[model samples]
Target: MSEVITGGCLCGAVRYRCTAAPNNVGLCQCERCQRQSGSAFLMATVFARDAVEFERGELKVFAAFDDDGQGLYRHFCPTCGSAVMITLDRYPEIRSIMGGTLDDKSWLKPTYSLWTSSGQPWLVLPPGIRLHPDYPDGAVA
Candidate 1:
């Protein structure tokens, strides 16, 4: 990726710029993701922690405990309650941004699907990508 990726919260209270290309792109089918996003799944792209820049405003972070009892921070705009990004304690170097907030997402390609065990039965994922029953093999479980 030659250019930086830009995004922000719904209320425009927070904005971000990512200089480094995303390390991971995928959809998560975990229940927590669905509950937090109020959707069927979480569509996100992960990048190095330092690659993300909060160019406009501050974000409110909610510490949510995962099924494994690990704490993860869900960062969002307090004004709109729009989830912007996330950081897991186990993966401090990685920050996952909500894809829906991206200013340009014409090149997104989800290479994996996480938590397939909890995915909706009607959801048919593409055949080539890795699909995990619970968590991916190298995932912090």
Candidate 2:
């Protein structure tokens, strides 16, 4: 088994653990993500839903559709308002942990990026990473 990945909200109000190895680390630069994250983009590390465990606190969720008209849900800590994870319609079995909330983000390296067309022009994406104009088919592993 891979080493566990753990994280939480900024205020320590919420925490989570991932038993499975995290893969498909990437960013979403869509308008909704930008607005919700209050940042240039949303960085995330993907894992299977069953592999993740909510170790503490309940998350408040906001449901919406992505720019591609796919169902999306954002889970965040109600107290600190820090986004913890997201569920995408394309891969209901997968859950994405917010990169910023990870306790050990030093090892975080995004290998692909979603919604490249909607990405900020000023932000330069690294070369060699897979760039998808929109959601890639079967994006989750």
Candidate 3:
């Protein structure tokens, strides 16, 4: 089995652990993601919600609608102001961990990229990963 992925916020106010290996990892260049991450793009990893647990700190959320008008919830650390995770409020069974929060970033390379149309020219994506101008079919996987 893959070793559990564990991490926390900058101030340790929020901590999380996921027993399931990430089924997908990718970068998102949607405007909201760009703004929230305060960078060129937002990197993310998907895991089953049943596989993740919050050891401490409550998650603070900002509700927003995604491209499909789904109820998207952006969660972060209240103390450190660090982006933590995001999820669809209606489906709590699947969860995403903000890639920036991983304890060991070496293994968190993105395998795909989404919303590339909104991606800035200043940012250069890594070579050899699938790039989707928008969400692909079965994107939830």
The prediction achieving the highest lDDT against the true structure is: 1
Report clash pairs, candidate 1.
none
- Predictions in order: lDDT: 0.86, 0.85, 0.85
lDDT over C-alpha atoms for residue 46 of model 2: 91
Winner by TM-score between candidate 3 and candidate 1: 1
- Candidate 3, residues 58-84, lDDT tens digits: the string is 989999975677888899998888999
Worst 10 residues of 3 by lDDT: 132-141
For every model shown, what is its TM-score relative to the native structure?
Answer: 0.92, 0.91, 0.91
Strongest candidate by TM-score: 1
Clashing pairs in model 2, backbone N/Cα/C closer than 3 A: none
After TM-score superposition, the amount by which residue 136's alpha carbon in candidate 1 deviates from its true location, in angstroms, is: 1.9
Worst-scoring 10-residue span by lDDT in model 1: 132-141
Q: How many collisions between residues are there in candidate 2?
A: 0
List, residue by residue over 33-64, the lDDT tens digit for candidate 1: 88889987888799898999999988988898
Quote the lDDT for 116 in model 2: 78
Q: What local lDDT score does residue 110 receive in model 3, on the 0 to 100 scale? A: 82
Clashing pairs in 3: none
lDDT of 1 at 8: 97
